[model samples]
Target chain A: MVDSVIQTKDLTKKYGEFVAVDGLNLEVQAGEVFGLLGPNGAGKTTTILMILGLTEPTAGSVRVLGLDPARQPLSVKSRVGYLPDQVGFYDELTARENLTYIARLNGIPDSQIDRRVDEALARVGLEKVAYKRAGTFSRGMRQRLGLADVLVKQPQLIIMDEPTSGLDPEASHEFLEMILDLKKEGITILLSSHLLYQVQAVCDRVGLFSQGKMVLEGTVENLAQRVLGGAYRVLVDVESVQPEIAQALEKIPGVAHVQVTDTKKYQVEAAHDIRPEAAQAVISAGGRLLGLGVQAQSLDDIYTAYFQGGSI
Target chain B: MTEAMAQKPAMPDERAVAALREREGSPWTGIWSVILKEMADHLSSTRIFILEVLILLAALGTVYVASQNIQQTTAEDQFLYLRLFTTAQQPLPAFVGLLAFFIPLVAIALVFDAINGEFSRRTMSRILAQPIYRDALLMGKFLAALFTLALVCTAIWLLIFGLGILRLGVAPGGEEVGRGLLFLVATIFYGGIWLALGLVFSVVFRQSATAALASIAVWLFFTVFWGMIAGVAAQTLSPIRIGLPDEFLAQANMELALSRFSPNTLYAETMVALLRPEIRSLGILLPTQLEGAILGAPLPLSQSLLLVWPQMTGLVAASILLFALGYVLFQRQEIRA
Candidate 1:
């Protein structure tokens, strides 16, 4: 069995009368990239803070790397690297100096600090600009430097909060690719982001958060199956749609629902890939099949479906 | 015997479990790193560099004028070396007066944004996420600022002494040096109160500008308006209704007590007793109480220190109290924003 690197049981946090995180039970297995998906102010950052022991939980317990964070913060913190949202560094210090300072704070030996900083910066693709001051870095570059800062400690578990927020599309793609590389190295990662589609490429599993609660948790595909009532969304464009075509597509085995989305396009939600059967139904109803393909279930559909009062 | 043998292994297991439950590592683990980093920042900052130059110019100008004045007048005084700090030339205050006015500014500048700057720059969470406890960060900033103030004060002291020896052509007495060293300590503590005040405001206010303004406002209050307010308060509290000696004494003591609430007043009293050894008491003394006392004889170094011990303690206590307040505030603040 894989080890659970992070485990929280009924973890909760409250600020005055407002409950920021309410009785959250979360677990992330080793070597898997877990995304905490939520809109802004959904208590994702609060949960991360409790796990890192930066803020005390109002109730419940959290263990990171098999150590209680509140009791063994130093040990947990040394092992679990965290990149806060809008992460910042000493702007006056060069990238190397910034990483070196964090390395020192983590108690990395002086003999290995330079090498570690160089390796971390190289890993983040920041070696060319290592001598430049952090203040001059762009938003994407600063995010990468934040990643380099985390990598300097060589942590067993890395937690990032809104790591890709406010980045251009290309930079966010490159950053997610880097995360996938870290996952290949068998490092457990937990990242939070409101941009669900951006995290979809790297996250192996995700927990959807709403109003300080984990509304749903599983693989994206699994969530799609559970929430959308199907694992596949097939779109069929017919040259001409007859009144019986919609009924014929619904009659196909494994097809769950059929909706006439436009003049000649039909959206078919199904339990499985019924693309072949769907094409046959369109053609047999005296209509020509123009195109038929399986639409990959993006997390956005599942998120909107879940929050739009759709049946779970 | 078998039961005891079985329990022996369990004892070590329980001990291991207890060890695991306890928090790992010392809170001071990265304190030295924080202190070194902050000290480097203070030493290299342009703001502090400018302040250092301003203070150096003030020290040189005041000490030069003072040494010249001492040479012309009071050349026969035995404690002419000590007079370098207290002697005021026309249109210029004494060196101690300058210190009392400028030390707070330097101290405030050093720490006005110490904590909030971290938040504004968004580095507080990242640094707090390190292995060290918050105690190390706050204390490191405080000690770094205090040490920087000490370094500046000591440099100015040595410069004044050098200037005194060069102009007066006489070495300072052993007693003068001791009193001077005590005065240096008092000066640092006086700066410490302002440093701690800046730190507290930094913890309280998120904007560095607001913290700086708040600290300077408190300093201005103490330096300018505290004495007048104390006079009015004491007159109202202990009015001289009958115009008796006792009423006068009561009002004087009351005024002194109220003025001591400000660090400026406490610092001023401390400087007077430490620099002028002939001072017998800081409080009002009836003539009948001093009838047979030797008029111009200087008290021993220890007695002068004893005379101002309360004032010195007041400065130290205020610094500690303000620092503790900041520590508590910083500890309670949520690291998230």
Candidate 2:
């Protein structure tokens, strides 16, 4: 068995009958970039709070590095780095000064703080404005500064909640590359995000969370096999708006769901390659099939299905 | 905002280094971090700068006026040094009275957003997640506020002392300096009570404005309306008829005790005792109770301190109690941004 760096058993958090997290069980190996994939109000933040020992679980246990965070949170916290959603820095402090404060908070000695802060700033590519106060930073720069803060801690595990949220695609791409680079360093990364495209690129394993419950958990490929069941999306762009074509395709045995994107375009979800059947049905239903392609069901479908009270 | 967003393109920072926390530092690593960070923040904040400037100007103006009055009245006066604290010009209070008012503003400025501002700025969770205990964080904030209070008060005290020496051409006597230092300490303690109140309100309310308003409201109630309320309460509690001196005395004594509950009253009484050494007791002593007492003799420094010892203790106790309450509430709260 691999060494699990974090484990939780039946972790439940209830705020006066509003259960934020319900009977959640989880395990992460020492160097896995795990993602808690969920929408808002799905208990992603609440679960992370419990794991961080900042919030007490109503009824459960959480262990990080084989130590109970509830009893010895200081040890767990000291060993784990956390970059919260919309991380904040002292606005008046320079980038270097902010990292220096974090270094000191992480118990890095005075002698090493300067060298480490410079390295962190250069790593995050903020060394140019290292002396600039955080108040002058843009949102993207602030986010990177938050990353610098986490790096200054040099913890074994780093947890980020919605790291790419509110970021432009370019910055989010760069951020993911950084996470992957961190993974290459063998540091465990547990991040939460609603964007499947973002998490799928870097996460080794994912826990699909919804309404305070762990609806599914596995490697992306494993989850794809388990929930999608070899399902593929057949995109058909027809020449004309065809309502009966989608209904006829839905009547096909393997086709499970069909979405009419527009009068000339629609998508079909099926358990197998339904492209030929979809094209035949569209043609027979008085529509010209201009183009058809067999596509695997993307992570978007999985989230929609899982959130709409269906596991698949 | 756009300038920040339009920052120049640069090569990304390196990422493949600095692994694993060494975990060798002491548990108290974050105290100095929080203290220094917040101390710098407090000092540089516009709110503090404005209030600090206002307080210094007020202190200097009042001291200058009081010194001019002292210079005019008595050139060979005994206890001329102590008069710097108590002497007032026409239409102006003494320097110590000025402190009793300004210290609250300084303390409130130092700490009105101690807890909730962190939550609003989204820094509380990150700070608390550090290796240090919550105790260190709370203690650090309080210690920093106290340090700021001590700094401001000591600077003002020195300025007053210097001004007095230049005006009177003599240094403060030993007893007067001792009493002045004690007064400064008591003033700090008095400021601590308001700082703690601000901290408690900050913890209780999430919005910074509400916390600030709440602290100010409490300060106003205690410093201004509390005496009137206590007097009314005493009268309501014990009514006196004509020629019933005993009942009147009981009413006055009850009023004194009730007013003592206010930190301002405690602080003011303590200052009066320290600056005016002829005062013996707070209670109204009858002729029989004052047997063999010297009417106008100055009290020793030790006797003056002893006279106001309970008031000092009350201020310190109130500050501690409020701080402890804030600490406990902060501990129990879920650290969410």
Candidate 3:
């Protein structure tokens, strides 16, 4: 059983009458990449801020590494790194200088600061441009510098808000690779993003948030199964298949529907495995079966299923 | 196994280890980081550097012109460079008096948007996110600005002193140097009051432009126009009058009192008290002998400081009070930019 590194009990945040986060309950296991998936204005950033103790919640409690964030924010913050959506830095300083300054702020020993800054810059693939002032850096380079800033402290948990929101495909890929490398070092991460593919690629588990509430939470596989109702698709090819072949496949156990696509192919859907029976039926019906395959569910399908025509 | 377990000591938990690491780190390191970073940015900004240099040149030029004009008119050459060394023996107050009136404006210009400009750049949230407390952040910025102001002002004061020694062909007396040192402290406090006021306005106003405008407005009202209006109002408001000229003098005193409401005025008045040993009031006093008979033969340096103590304390305290207010506001603001 994995232990919880970050846990919140009924965490809420309100801006006057508007509830930004309401009764948010979350448990992220140690060493796991947890994704907070939500649309715009869904309170993901607010939730992350509260967990980092940067913002006071309206009510409820938050614990990181089993310590109350509100009562011991420095303790929690010391072990957790955060990147706001909009990264702000001193434009007059070079990337290396920025990282070195942040390292000093994090209280790294003066003797070790240079090594840590170099290591962080290397990890973010920014060592080549480390001496360039951040004001002259591109958007992608700035994002990398931000990642380096967080990495310099080597926190136990890293929380990122829309880390790849503005990056192009190549930049996003590079950023994801960096995150994956961090994961290999046994650092737990809490990432909030609207990109489903990125979350599906990286997150060990994800929570779907909507309008200040966690509507669903589970592993990617589990969410896909739960939202898509455990449905499986089987595609078969046949030679000289009859309309009766389609009816025969449906009559078999567990199969839901069979649609004939062409003279020698049919699309089969079932709530469970009906491949064995469907194969037997096709052969017994004097149709020569050529191929059979199951269709894997995609995160896009699950995302649409949860968000379509549903209220949080 | 059970006996071995009982004999072995318990190790610290992960949470305890993390807490130890945090406690081992000094929080003030973050405050120093912010100060260093802000000072670096301020020094590198071309606009502020150019402004500082221009203001310094203007101050030097004004003192030079005033000295030369004094010498040309007096025909004795006694007043040449005398305005720079001391206000003594000169019919008019020294150029330092003009500096006292003008330096606060330059200082205020430098710092009026110090805090609000950071907010405009959206850098406050990032800086605040570090481990530093809000009070440390505000205090660090204030101190850094004050340090910069002091450095610039000191350089200008030295330049003026050097020019005076060159022109007069005589070294200044120890008392003159003592008075000059006292003037420097008074000038810093004067600039400090304006700096603090600017920071308070910076905190109160969200926009840098608004903060700058508000600071300039306060500067003008106190330095240039508020005393005139207050004089007129005091004349109309007062029920009794001694005589025409005396009433005007009374009105002027009332205006001076009212102008003290501005830190700029308080600074100028305090500096006058410290720099000019002969100056008795904002108004001209009777010749020193008659004045000495009324008070004493000669007032001690300590007594003169005591006379201006309220004004000095008021300016210093107001600066501190404004800073405290800014600190509280900064602490209460959400770190979200």
Candidate 4:
């Protein structure tokens, strides 16, 4: 069993009468890439702020690395690195100077600051423009600089809110690779993103939050299976006619429906794995099978199923 | 067999280990870092450097021209060395007066936006996320601005001293030098009061431009317009009839008391005390039979200082009070950015 790195029990944050985060209980395990998947106004940012001790939680406790963020924020912050959804930087300083300043604030030794700064810049592929003022940097470069600021400290747990919210596809792919690289170094990363495909690609586990509560928490595969129901799709290509193939496949146990598109193509819906028996029946019926594949549910399907139904 | 036997090492519980390694220390480290950065930026800016050099040269040139004019016309060197080194006697009291006014304005301009600009740039939230506390941030900023002002004042002071030695061909007496140092301290305190006032406005106002505008407005009101308005108001509202001695006395006291309220008046009065070392009372003295008899006797320096102690304390206390209020506002403010 993996030990939990971050645990929030009955955590709630209220702004006036509006409950921004309502009794959120979350457990992020050590060395896992956890994604907080949510739509706008889902309180994901608010939750991250509470965990960082930026915003006070109205009720309950948040423990990061077994330290209460509210009571011992310095300890939690010293160990964790955070990249806010909207990146803000000092425009007067160059990228190198900015990273050096952040490194100093993180308590790195003066002798080691330059080396760490160079390493961080290199990690983000920003060494070429490191000496240029950040004000002149493009949005993508600024985002990369913000990532370097986090990476310079070599923080154990990195919390990024909407890490790829505004990135182009190529930048997003590069960022995902960096995140995976960090994960490989045994760093725990918790990121919030609206892009389900991006989350599906990198996250080891995910928590789907909606209406200020965690609606679902599991691995991507588990969430897809649980929320999308047991409907399995099987696509096949036949060598010859399939009008009788559909009728014969429909008669198989646990097979719900069968539809033939062309003389060689057919889609079968089943409650279980009936592919073997269906293939055998199709062959016996003189329909030679050309190809066979199982269709798994996508993240979009799981997202739509949970949100549209208002429950997981 | 090799694949079956291969195993990963135990992951060192990062969060737990980091918690164990946490140390206790002052939270002001990050704030000092910001203050250092602000000072370095201001000091390194080309615009500020040019302004400083221009102001310094202008002041020295004015003093030099005034001394030369006095020597050419009057053939008396009494006001020569004094005017060169100090603002004791000059054709342009307004120039010296503007020096007192503009130095504070410039210092305040350098720091008024120190905190608010960070917020406007949205960097305050990022910095505040570090281990530093709010008080540390404010105090660090105050110190940085104070240090910068001190540097400017010191530079100007040394330049004047150098000019005096070169032009006069004699070093100043200990008393004269002592008075000059006191003037420098008073100038710093005066400038600091404005710096604190500017920071207070910065905290109270959301926009940096608004804070700066408010500071300049207050400076203009006190330095340029307030005294004129007070004089006019006194003339219009005077209940004392023109002919009576008692009326004159009452009006004189009222004017003297009211003058102390403005920082400009307070500073001027303090400079007068330091320069003259006589005129024990700021209030006007009634003409008497003994007035003509004791005109030659100068008051002792100790008595002179004691006479002005209340006014000096009031001005310094006002500065301190403004600074304390600024500190309190900064500490209580939420770091929203």
Candidate 5:
């Protein structure tokens, strides 16, 4: 029942001989955080620009919120907010003035402008600094102000290009929390970043981009299973080694593979949590289980393995 | 719950759907917002404040000296008000002459960084993301700069007139006032040409300093060397062979035409025709052609305007051409930054 907020069909953008965004089909459903994970020069920003109708694609098409971005750009832009990388503001204007300018550009009624700007600023924890010149604020403060700028538009969807790229760890964490808060209000968020761990922390689904193309996409856990066979690595140590124990562990319903790392230790892989089943199987196979634990794989490990394996 | 939700078609909110179905407004929407914002920036910037002060001082000094000299030398002249603008007192040029120099500087200062400054500040993409067309942004900046130029020129014009009336104890004739207003309009469009030129460079160059330097370089070439270049070009194109009268006239006409290509020449010509109406022709006048002419008799305001119609149109056309060039360059530019 989820509506597709953004749907692109074979969208491609080229600058002379160099292709910036290859023919790509991307779909983002309503109310979910979709992360576009890619290294620099991987065409994430180009894709965002095309979706916002800021740049024309060389071929194919884009639809955002049921409107063709190229044909109905005003409609698309008014409803979808974009926070560009290293978002900038007028150094001379105060934070309130900056947000007020954006609100007016969005055609918010004069009577509602003050209310909307104040509400957005307060939402980003920037109300205290609202009267200060943006140039005087710290980098992290500017990013928050950028989020406030987007919120003033009351957008149905928000697109951010590397929103957390240049922030301290605490600031980035705070920004992600604000994004999660927006998600709680049923606002669909599409953010691009090369920081895998951050994306994994916030995105419900993610697409891996390489050289202007989406090489793989899905939930982080699903991608982990697809690439690593199984991400749940359960390590088992038994007092006695038995061939029957390995066979029994492999019989678990969700188990994908098993390997003997030592004379008395076994590494069991499963699509999902099967640690209890693994323990039962090891004991029933006439092996005395001494220790058992699981090592959860992270998105960084998944991304590294995915690229190092040259799966593209 | 999931099965039930999957089977049923979710109906979109009626009001929300209707809002989306409403026809989008004209591409010019929010253009005023942009213009107001830019105009505020131009009027408040320290650079403009200094330029305004420089212009004011120049106006006060020139008009004061010109009025004092006019009182001493031409107290009985019928066009004493017009004299305030054109009479040069030693070591200082007339107000109109000063305008010929300062107009372009003020215009260039207003707009040399209009577009590229947005990129350098990293605000271009964010602003373009608003629910407005690129046309609005470009046109809005142009009109704002034009308006700013007009405001400054009008203020100086009024100041000169006020000083003229106060010092000379005489009111300007209706025709004199009308001519003065036309002079002000010409001054604005003269500035408009440079504003548009600066905009073109701003669009072409990503660095504000480069755009500023390029605009000033073009202005310097036109102001300092264009007249000489026009003469040399006319000599090459239409040589005055054997010293025939017709050939001399042809070379003169060709040179005038070539010089008019520079906005400085056009603006200067327009100012002469408007401020000093006694002049019968802007080109070589044969004795035979002036057989019945009354020397030194100022023509009616309408005839003077007719004489400078081409020059005035040339100023406007140059501004429009440059603005169109900037618009095309900006529309093609990528907003990635």
Candidate 6:
């Protein structure tokens, strides 16, 4: 039986009448990247805070590494590193110093700290600017340093809240790669973010959250399929527009619509792979097919559908 | 990532063993870590450097003028070594007066931003997320700031003593040295009250600038204005009848007790009682009460401590009260940016 690194049973958090996280039950295995997808005020951060034992749950229980986070937060915190949203460091301190401070907080002995600090900084690609004050670093670099802060402890579990929220595209890519590397090293990761593509890139499983409720949870592939037979899209290049083809494509069973992109292109969405039939339909409709290819349903589509209070 | 997730979990009882190990480690997980980090930050910061230098120069300048003027022997020829604290030149106040005025400034500066600045800079949540309990972080900040204040005050005291020895050529008697050390401890405790007050403001106010202003405003009220206000309040609360010593006595004692509510007045009283041991009483005494008192006779160090014991305890109680307020508020605070 594989024990989950983090298990929350009907976790709920309420501030006065406002429920921040409502009856959230979640489990993450010992070594996987789990993304929590949510919009602002979706209680993602509140749930994360409860898991880290930073805040107490109004109801239910949390077990991190099989230890009750509320009763034994030190044990849980010592092993489960957290990277808060918009994570910050001691701006006046150098990256090395900041890491050193966190390493000490983890009770890493002074003799081992220097080596660990160097390793963490290097791992985050901050070795070149290790001595620079964190205040001088760009927002992207600071986010990288937040990663280093989490890694410096050599934790068994790492939780990052919107870890790449402020990073540029290239930096976000590197950050996601770092998350993958940490997962490869057997660190359980739970990251919460609204950036669908970034979360899809690295997260093994994801939970869609809305207004403090876990609306859906599954592997991205599983969700894509389960939501709407994983709605497949077809990009069709035609020699000319068929005035009737768009309506005919829509008339096909399970096809939502066929959008015309010029006189020569049409995009189709269907509940299943319909590219071949789409091409045949185009031919029968007297349109010369230049190209046709099937596309998978993206996380964005499922996410949008979920937020719209409907299934894809 | 999928392959890693597919890997088997750890041995069934590994978590139990880890829990046992965590329980066995020392509970004081991060006191030294917080203290060292904060201490380095305090000592290296330019703001602290400027405050220390400012107080040092102002104190040195005043002590220098006083030492230059108070050279003649008095009829009593008593507490010559003690004159370092009490003697004032034509323009400059005594060392104690300068300290009574300046130490709060230094202390308030050190602590007004201690907690809120961490929140504003977004380090509070990260630091508290460590294995250490909330108690350690709050304690570490208090101790570090207290340690810094002690260091600054001790340096100033030593410099003044050194200057006294060089200029007056009179080595302090052992008793006088003991009294001076007690005065130094008292001064730090006094600074501690302001430090705790500043920390309380920091905890209550999210903005560092607001905390700083609130702390300084409170200190100013107590240091410069509270005594007068307390006097007026006491008079309004306890009106006196003409030619009735008991009524006047009631009014005077009321005023004195009300003023002692301010740490500045308590500290000034303690400094005066300890540094000027020849002073025998703090309260307004009836003529009959002064009959047994030998004029200008220096009290023993033990007697001096006895006289100011309540003041010392008051300073300590105020510090602990302020710190408790700050600590409770800090613990209740949600560590979010």
TM-score winner among the candidates? 1
- What shift in Å separates residue A276 of candidate 3 from its native position after superposition? 5.1
Candidate 6: the clashing residue pairs are none
**TM-score of model 4 relative to the true fold?**
0.82
- Residue pairs of candidate 1 with colliding backbone atoms: none
Q: Write model 5 residue lDDT over B1-337, tens digit each, in one string.
A: 9988865654444543674575466878899999999999999999999999999999999999989988875556878888889989789999889889999999999999999999999999999999999999999999999999899889988989999889988888999999999999999999999999999999999999999999999999999999999999999999987999889889999999999899999999999999998987888788999999999999999999999999999999999998999999999999989
Q: What CAPRI grade goes to candidate 1?
A: medium
- Per-candidate chain B TM: 0.92, 0.89, 0.76, 0.80, 0.92, 0.90
What class would a CAPRI assessor give candidate 6's docking? Answer: acceptable
The per-prediction tally of clashing pairs is 0, 2, 0, 0, 0, 0
Q: Provide the overall lDDT of each model, using Cα atoms, as 2-decimal numbers.
A: 0.91, 0.85, 0.76, 0.77, 0.92, 0.85
TM-score for predicted model 3 compared with the true structure:
0.84
| Candidate 4 lDDT over residue span B75-137, tens digit each | 433324335544434545433565675676776677678778878877776666666666667
Off by over 4 Å in 2: A231-294, B1-29, B72-75
Task: Please tell me what DockQ candidate 5 reaches.
Answer: 0.44
Compose the digit string of candidate 3's lDDT tens values, residues B146-180.
Answer: 77777777887788878766655566655556666
User: What does candidate 3's lDDT look like per residue over A1-312, in tens digits?
Assistant: 238998998999999999999999999998899999989999998999888877888988888888766657666776788877867777778899988887877778999999999998988888999898888988888888888888888899999888998899999999999889889999999999999999988999999999999999988778765776656778888876688788888788766668877555787766786778889999888789898888766677778878894643
Candidate achieving higher lDDT, 1 or 5: 5
C-alpha root-mean-square deviation, each candidate: 3.2, 10.0, 6.1, 7.7, 5.4, 5.4
Interface RMSD of each: 2.0, 6.4, 4.3, 4.2, 4.0, 3.6
DockQ of 3: 0.35
> Over the stretch A22-135, how does candidate 2's per-residue lDDT look in tens digits?
999999998899999988999999999889878889987787888767666777887898999999887878888878877887778899999888888888899899999898
For model 5, residues A164-196, the per-residue Cα lDDT tens digits are 988999999999999999999999999999999
TM-score of each: 0.95, 0.89, 0.84, 0.82, 0.92, 0.93
Candidate 2 residues B267-316, lDDT tens each? Answer: 99999898899999876789997899999788888998999999999999
Each candidate's fnat, in order?
A: 0.82, 0.62, 0.37, 0.38, 0.80, 0.68
By TM-score, is 2 or 3 better?
2
